[model samples]
Target: MLVEVGASARLFGGLEQLRQRIEVEATAMGVECIAWAPTGTAALALVRAGVPDGFASPLPCILDKLPLETITAVASHQGTLQRLGCRTLGDVRKLPRGGLSRRFDKELLTRLDQAYGLRPEVYEWVQLPETFSARLEFQFRVEHAPALMFGARRLLLQMSSWLAARHMGVTSFTLRWWHDVMRAKTAGTGGELTVGTAEPTQSVDHLSRLLNEHLAKVELQAPAGDIELIAARTIPIQQESKSLLPDTIRQGEATWLVLERVQARIGKAEVVRPLLAEDHRPEWMQRWPGAEEPRPRSAPDPCQLPVPDWIFEEPLRLAERDHRPIYQGPLVMLLGPDRVEGGWWHRVGEGADAQQTNVQRDYWVAQSQHAGRLWIYQQRLANDETGWFLHGRYA
Candidate 1:
C-alpha cells in the first residue's frame, strides 16, 4: 500500500518528529504495519527487492539497477526479505517482470510502487464502541489509593446507571487511568476483577453484591490520580417466562445451578456425557458425559440372521475338544452367519491395499444362556479354516 503525504517531511517538524508521532499513535492503537516517508509528488511505486533507498534520486538509471528488497526493507522488514535469491535491488531490476510475477508475490511489486510514491495509500485508526466510558482530565494528578478508589466508585455508579437503562449486567470490564507526575503522590496502575453471576439480575444492588465480592481482592500497583471506568463487557438478563413452572422443575433449576457451579469451579471438561462415535473403530465409539437421548435398537425381523446379546471386548481363547471347534461359553444373543470372501486380488505386504486386505468374514448373532446380549463371529478362510471372535454387542 502506498501512503501519499501531501506536504514535505519538513512540514511535520521533520522526519524524526513525524516518525515519533506515528510510533505513539500506533502503540496506543496497536498498529504494527510497515510505513515509509519519501520525498516526491505523485510518487511512482515499483517493487524491486534489491533496489537502493536512492532509487528515486537524481540517478534515473538506478531504477533499472535497484532491487525490490531495498524498497521493501526500508518499508517493512519482513523475515522473507532475506530469503530471496536475488542479491540486491539491481539484481531484481535485471529479472523479467513476467518471470518475477511467477516467482515472487504481488506484495513486492506493491511495496516498490509505494516506495516511489506512485500508488495511493491510506490508514484509518480503529474506532471503539459507544459505551460507559468516563475519562478524567487532570491538571494536577491526585495519587492516593483512597482518592482513586473514590473516583472509581463514581465511575462505577455511572456504569451502573447505563446498565440499568439497558436492563443488563456487566460480567467483565477493565478500567484505565492516565497518570500525571505533578498531581498524584504515588504512581500506581489500576487492577482488574472478575465479577460473578447475579441470579436473574437487573438490579444495581445485585451487581454491587458481585462487585463487592471481588473488590476485597483487588489491589493497586501505584497511587491512582485520574480514573476512567469503562463497561468492558456485559450479559443480558434472561427473559421472564409467560408460563409458571411447577416445584419439581424449579428444583431442577437448582440442580442445574449446582452443576454449573461445579463446572465453573472444576472446569467444563470435567463434566461430560457419553456420545456414540461414527467411526467403525471400536475404541473410538462412546463419549463420557454422554448424549441426552438414549440410542435406539431393534431386532432383525424374520430371525434369518442370528444376533448376539454380548460380544467380547476382545476375542477369548477356547479349549478345542476335537478336530471340529467346540464352542463353550456363557453366550448372549447370537447374530449372523453372513459370509464375506475376497482378498485374493490384494497385493501381499501392501497393508492397506484392498486386494491384499481382502478376506472372508462370517458374521453371527449369538446369545449366551447366562451372559447378556452379544454379537460374535468367526473369521472363516476361503478354504474353510475358522477362528472364533467377538465383534459387537447390543446394550
Candidate 2:
C-alpha cells in the first residue's frame, strides 16, 4: 500500500518516528516487505524494483532506476516513446506535453506529474469496523484443538490490524470451530471457546499466547472443518505517555497478562482473591473467590479491644480448673470480655421446646504458660450450662 505520510509527519512527531511506527505496525500484522519513497508512485515503484527507502530525486536518473512495469498502464505508447528516443520517465517528460497528451491519454501525463510531486496525491482512507469477526477454512480437517493454531494466528493478525486502526483494545473474544458434516453425529455441529483478559490489550503476541494455553487444554470431540474468531468485547485504549523512569502501568499490564495466561491454562475458578464480609464472627469475616480488588473493612479502636491474629475453623473445648480455663496450665486473661450474641433467626419459627440455635459468648485474649497467647471464649447456655473453648492463637 502506498501511504502518503508527508502531510501526517508532524502528527506522528516526525518523518523518522513516523517511519519507525509504520514499520512496527506492519511487522505486528505480519507484513514482510515494506519500502518508503518521497511520492506514492515512487514508493510502489521502489518496492517493485526491490529497493528499500528508494527516495526519487528530482533528477532524470530516477527514471532509469525504476522498472519498466512501473509504466505498464501506458503500454500502448511504449513503442512510440521508444521511437522518440525516450528511454525513461524523465525523457518522456522532456517531450512536449501538448504532443504527449495528443498521442496518449491524459492519465499518462497525470501519473508522471504525480510521481514527480507536481500534483497533489489523494486517496480514500480505510476505516475499521465496530466489531471484528473472521473465519478460516482448512483444506484438511483438524483432529485436535492445537491444530487450529495456524488458522487462529491468521485471524489474530487481522484482529491486530483492526485494533490498531481503531485505536482500541480487546478484553474478551470467542473462538468457535465447526466439525465436518461426516462427523456431525459424534461431535455435534461445533464447539466454542471463550477467552478474556484481565485488562484490555492490543498485543498480538499476548493474545496468541493466551489462546495457546487455552487450546492446549481443549479436547476436540471430532474433526474440525473450519474455525472462527469473534471479538466479544472491546475497550478504548489510549497511547501510553512516554516516561524517563520505568513505566508502572506497563509493568502492571504485564503482570495481569501473566495472570490471565495462568488462569487460561488452569481454570478461572482456581484463581481468586479475598473479600471482606460484614460479620462479627472471625471465621465468617472473609469470603474467597472474590473480586480482583480486595474490599477493606473498618478497624476498631485498638485501645477499646484487641482482636486475635488467627481464628480456628472449629474452636477447641477447654477444661477449667478453679474457675479459670486451663491449657497445660491456668490461663491468665490479658484482654476484655467482649460480648457477641445472636443466631436466634435459625430457630425463629420453631416451638419453645425446640433446641436453642442462638449463641452468646464472652471472648477474651488470654495467655497460658505453655500455650503462649490464646483466644478463648466462654459460651453461655439456656440450661444454665457454660463452657470454655480455645478459639484462636497468636504467634
Candidate 3:
C-alpha cells in the first residue's frame, strides 16, 4: 500500500500530520509494519529492507541503504554487478543506461527509473462499496454466541476500515449465524439478530460492546458454523473542526450509544419517549413510545388554567359535603372551573350502546387542608348525579 501523499499533504495539513494519520489508522486496523519514502519504489524497497521513515534521506543514500535482495528484478545480476565493482544502487546507476538495458534485463532499468522518479508511478485506488456484508467461517462450530466474539472482532475491524474509507457511519447492522445442519437440533437452518443505534457511529469499541450485550442474551438452537455481519443502514459523516472543549454533539452521541446498548441487552420496547395524544381526558392526554426527539406540546390557554404536575391513572373519588367535595378537610377552590366535554363518538363503536362513554367535567385547581395542592374535577352526569374526584397534585 504505497500511497503518494505529496499532493495530499496540504489537505491533511502537512506531510508529518498525514503520516501520523496513516499510522493511527494502520494501528487501528492491526497493521504491524509501515514505511514511507519520497517515491513509490523507494517506499516499497525501504519496507522490504525493514527500514522506516526514509523519506527525508537522499535518493542515493536511500537506494544504497537497501540490500541487493530487496530489488527482485536485479537480484539475479547481483554477482555480475559485484564483478563490475558495483556494490549498491548508486554504483549501478553510474553505468550507461543504453548498455545496462542491453546487457541486463529491461526490468533493472525500469526499477532504476521508477526509484529515481525519472518515470511516473501509477496506482489503482481502492473504493468502498455501497453496502457492507462480510462473512467468516470457523474451523470448529461455535456452540454459543459468546464464542463468536473472536470472529466478530475480526469482522468489526474490517468494518471499521470500510467505514473509514467511505467516510461514513452506520446506525444499524445485522449479525446472522448459520447453524450446523448435520448436527442441528433446531428447525431452522440459521438465525439472525439486528442491532440499532440511536445515533450513527464508526467506533469499533462502541459497536463491539453493543454486539456483546446482544449476543449474551441469544439462545443458540444449534452450533453456529459461520457468522456474517451486514451494515444495512449508513449515513454520511461530515468532518467537524476540532475544538479544545468537549463537543456537545459527541457527548450526546456517547449518551445515546449507552442508551442503545442497554436497549439491545434488554428489549427495544423497554426504552420509550413520551408522546402527547389528541384526547382531552387528563389520563389519555399523553402516551409513551415516540420519536427520539420529544415534540413539545402547545401550552394550554391562560383562560383554561394550567394542569397539575402529577396526574393519577384513575381519578380518586371524593366524599360529598354540602354539594361540594371534601378531601382531607374542606377543599378550597383557588381557580375557576375549566370545562372539558368530549368522548361522544366512543359510544358509536360496533356492539356499543350510548352508556357513560361521554365526558363533561368541571376541572379546578384546589387546595386541600392536608393533601396540599390538588387537581379536582366534578363529573357532570345525564342522570343529574354529579360526583367530585381528585385528579392530580401539584408541588
Candidate 4:
C-alpha cells in the first residue's frame, strides 16, 4: 500500500493560503491529505507512519491512551506475532480489551483498527512547494566590508535550515555588487567573484568562512556598491564514511581563508610568490616578487644548480684598481659577462640622452675567498666612467 502526506509551508503569504495550496498539490498527486493542529501529536503520528491494525478511520485520540498490548495479542493469535521493537500491535492484541480500557484508554485500539484497514481513514494532505526565495534592497549603496558581511550572513542562515530540512547542501551562490548610475544609462562599475566549494557543505559557519575569505581579498573600485546574495545550487547528503582525522585537517581551509583576508587588507601587489629568473647575471637571475598569476607547477630541473637564498636588491660599488675593480675572491665559477644590447632605435633620435639612459650592460658573477659566496655584477668600460656594480650575493 502507498501512503503520502503533503504539508503547506508559506514563503510570504499567510498559513491558510499555504494549506489550501498544499491540498491542491496533494489532489494532483492522487493522495488525500489533511492539516492537523501544529501541536496535535495523534494526528502527526498517524500522518507520519499511517494508521495501524484495529484502529478507527481518521483516528482521533491521544497516543498515550491506546490499547497497544491487546492489539499485539490478536496478531499473535493469528500466528503473525512479530516483535517490532516494543511498539508492535501484537503486544496490544494480547492484553485483555476490558483491562486495557480500565488501565489507560481506547485510543490505541481505535488507531490500530484504522491502521489495518478495519475502518476507512481519510486525510487531506497539503504539500509545500519545493523552493523558497527572497530579496532585499538597500536604501543606500553599501561599499563597506561590514555591511556586505552582515547582509550575506542573514541570507545564509535562512537558506541553511531550509536546505537542511530537504537533506541538501547548496553548491553555489551569486553576490551582485552594484551601484546607481552616475551618468545617463550606464551604471557605476562593479565586479563579482564566482566561488565554488571543494565539497558540498550546508553549515552556515562553513559557508560564511569560505565566502569571507574570498571577499576579504576583493577590492571594490567604488566605495558604495550594493551587495546581493543568492543561492544557486543544492544537493542531498547520503551516508558516507566519517573522516579519520576530521579536526586536524579541517583547520587548513580556515587557515587559507585567514590568509586571504590578510591579503585583502594589504594591497594585493604586496603579497607575492617569488620566482627565480634563469640568467646567472645578478639582476637578470634574481627572483621577482608577485608574479602575475599562478604558473603551472613543475618539478625543478635536476640539471640546474640550486641558488643561494639572498640576492642583493641593489648592486654594491666595488673599490676600483687600474680602471678594473680589484677582485679578491676564490674563483669558483664565472657565471656571466653576458652582453645586453637594446634601445638603439630610441637612441637614434634622442642621441646622447638615450645613450645615457639606455646604455648596454654586461653582467658577471665573482666568488669571494673570505666567505664562499657568489657576488653579481656588470662590466663598465672606463672611458664612459663605466665600473662594475655588485648586484647580488649567492651563498
Candidate 5:
C-alpha cells in the first residue's frame, strides 16, 4: 500500500486526483485507514495515529508529535522509556544515543531511523490467488431475494479489486447461497444461478446491475443464512488509458452489450435483433436472432439507391386493373423496373408460416394518388395466379 506517486502524479491528473482515486479504490476494498508520507515507516506511524494525510506537514515535524506507542518496536519498550521521561518519539530522539542503544534492542533505533527517512525500507509483496471465491455470512437469514444486494455488493467490490490487481476480466460467475437449518429437505439447501456477460469485464456496476435483475426474478426456496460468489472464468484484458487531451471524443460500447443487458432484464428469447443475411431479396436479407446471439458479419451495401423505409411481414397482394397495380387508385411508375431474381436455391418456412422463397420479379418505384410512393414488384412467374404486389413503402 506504500506507493510512490510523486513521479506520476501529473500523469494521473495531479496529486489531488491521484489521492482521490487511491482513496476510492482503497475504501472499496474495505481499507479502514490510509496516509501518505515520503517514507514508508513515517506513513505507517501516521496511519496508526489516525492521521489520514501525513503529507500536509514536514516529515519529522509530524512524526515527532506521534506517541511512542504508535510503533510496535518503540511500544514494547514504552514503560521503560516513559520512566526515563520519554513521552513522545521526539522525547526518545533527545535521549543519549549511546544510553538508548544500550537500554533498548536494536529494533528501537532501527525503527526510529526508518521513521525519519534516514534508513531505507523494504516491502514484502503479496501473492494474489489464481481464482477468486468469497463467502459472506448474513446476520439475519434473508427471506426476500432483493434483501441480499447489500451483502452481494460487498462481495462484488472485493472481486473487482482482485480482478484489477491481477489484471484480468471476469466472463462469468456463480452466486450460491445456503439455506437455514430449519428449512425443509425437499426445498433443497438453496438455489443458485450463473450470471454471464457477453464480454469480459471488471466493471462492478455492470455486474451489480445484472445481478440485481436476476435476483429480482428468483424465488427463494428457503431462508438464506449465507452467500458465496465464485468467478467461473477470467481472461486477461488490455487496459486502455484515457486520453489526456481535452478535445478527444470518447467512444461508446458495442451495440451487443446493450442487447445483452436488455436480455438479462427481460427474457433472452424475448429480445431479438435484426442481423444481415446472405440473400439478395429484401425479406430474406435479414434474420431475427436472440439478443445474446453473436451477429454475423455482413458486407457493405453494394447498391447506390436507398432502401425502402419499411418492408411488410408478407408482400401485400394488390388489386390489378388495366394491367397495372392499384392500391387505392391507379398507380404511376416513378422509377424503372429493377430486376430482382434470386432465392431459388432456398426454401422459406413450412406450414402456416411459409413465405415466398423464390423471388423472380421486376421491382418498381410506384406512387398512388391516395397512398403515396410505394415499392411494388411484378411476379415474373408464368403461373396464372402471378400478379403485382406491394412490397414496401418509402417514408
Candidate 6:
C-alpha cells in the first residue's frame, strides 16, 4: 500500500513517527517488509529489495545505482536491455530518450520516469464505506462468549485504524455471532450485544475491557463459528491542539469510565448512583438511579444543615417517653426543628397497593449518651395524631 503522507504527516506527529507506527502495526500483522522513500515507485522498489529506508541518499543517486531488475517492467526486458549494454538504471538514463521511447514499450519508459520522480503516479486509495461491519470466522468453534475476544480484538484494532482515518470516534458498537451448523436446533442461530461508552472514544483497551465485562456474564447456548462487529454510532472528533508550553500535570480517567466498566461487570440495575431531588423531605430529597441512566446535569442539591452519615431505607418508629423521642435512653434535643413539610404529590403505587406518602415532619438533631448522634423527626399524622421516628444516625 502506497500512502501519500505529505498532507497528513503533521497529524500523525511527523513523517518518522507515522512511518514507525505503520511499520510496527504491519509487522505484528505478519508483514515482513516495509519501506519509505521520496517516491511511490521508489518505495515499492525498496520494499521489493528488502530495503527498509532509502531516503538517506538523494533520489537520483539512489535510483542511479539500483539494478534494472528493481522495477518489474524493467526486469522483464532485462535480457534485451543487457544485450544493448544497459545494466543499471543510470546506464539506461544515459541513452537518448527519443530512441528509448521509440525502441521500448511504453510501460518501460513510464516506470523509469515514475521511479525517478519525473512523472506523476496515480493510486486507488482506500475507500471507507458509509458503515463499518467486520466479521471473523473461527477455525475451532468457540463455546463461550468470552473466548471470542481474541478474534474480536483483531477486528477492534482494524476499527481503530478506520476511525483514525476518518477522524471519528465511536459512542457505541455491536458484536454479534453465528452458531455452528452442528449445534442443536433449540440453541437458535446466534446472539448479539451492544457495548456503549459514556464518551466518544477510540481507545482499544477501554473498549475491549467493556466488551469483555459484558461477555463474561453471557451464557452461550451454541458454539459460535463466526463473529461480527458493527460500529453502531460514530461522531467526528476534533484534533487535539499542541500546547506551546510543556505539560506537567497528568490527568486520570473520567469517573464515568470506571462506573461504566463496573456496570458492565455487575448488572446495570445493580450499580446505582445517588441523584439529589428538589424535595426537602429526607427520603423524598433524593433517588438512586443506575449509572447508565440519565439525570440532572448539576451539582448535588444544597442543604444548610449537615447531612447524616447514614440514612435508613425506612424510618424507624421510636418509643416516646415524656413527649420526647427515645432510643436506648431518653433523647436530648440539641438542635431546634428543621421543618420539612411539603410532599403531598409524592404518592407511589396503584389501587390496593397505594400508600400515603405525604409527610409533615419536624426534624431535629438529637443526642443520646449511649448513641453518638441521631436524626429524629416528629410526624404530624392525620386526625392531629403525633408520632416520633428515627430517620438517620451519625457514628
Tens-place lDDT per residue, model 1, 1-395, is: 34444454676878668767755644443334533435331122232332224423553344544443345432353344346555555455456878656766776665555444456655573433457677655445554433454445545665665676676777665556655544335534444444444244444444443444344444555544565666767777665554565443443334433543554445556766556544232333344751223444642232345434444566664334443223455443334567655545535455565345455556566665544455555666457666766565567
lDDT of 5 by residue, 1-395 (tens): 66767888987899899999989977875679999888878888889999877778788889889998788899999999889998999999998989888878999999899989888877786677999999999899899888888788889988998898899999999998999999998889887879998888898988988888889899898999999999998999889876667755659866766766787888888888788777667777788987667756766454323468998889998988877789999999988677778777776678888765677888889988988889988896466557899988999
Q: Per-residue CA lDDT of candidate 3, range 294-322, in tens?
A: 46667433336678888888889999889
- Candidate 2: tens digits of C-alpha lDDT, residues 230-345: 99999999977677897654335556677777788777788777766665656555678623443466643332356677878898999988777899989999997988777665
Q: lDDT (0-100) at residue 64 of candidate 5?
A: 86
Better of 2 and 6 by lDDT: 6
Record all residue pairs in model 3 with backbone atoms less than 3 Å apart, i.e. clashing: none
Decoy 3 TM-score against native: 0.79
Could you tell me the lDDT of residue 84 within candidate 4?
30
Residue-level lDDT tens digits of model 4 in 261-374: 455456457767656554333344335564334544763333123345676666677766654554474344456655655433333336455443244666565666765555
TM-score pick, better of 3 and 6: 6
TM-score ranking, best first = 6, 2, 3, 5, 4, 1
Of models 1 and 5, which has the larger TM-score?
Answer: 5
What value of lDDT does candidate 4 attain over all alpha carbons? 0.53
Cα TM-score per model = 0.33, 0.80, 0.79, 0.43, 0.76, 0.81
Could you tell me the lDDT of residue 349 within candidate 3? Answer: 42
**Cα deviation of 29, candidate 2, in Å:** 2.3
**Which residues of candidate 6, in runs, are more than 4 Å off?**
6-14, 28-32, 56-100, 135-144, 178-191, 218-226, 299-305
Off by over 4 Å in 2: 7-14, 56-60, 75-96, 135-144, 150-154, 157-161, 164-167, 177-191, 221-227, 242-255, 291-304, 344-358
What ordering of candidates by lDDT runs from best to worst? Answer: 6, 5, 3, 2, 4, 1
Go through the candidates in order and give each one's C-alpha lDDT: 0.50, 0.78, 0.81, 0.53, 0.85, 0.86
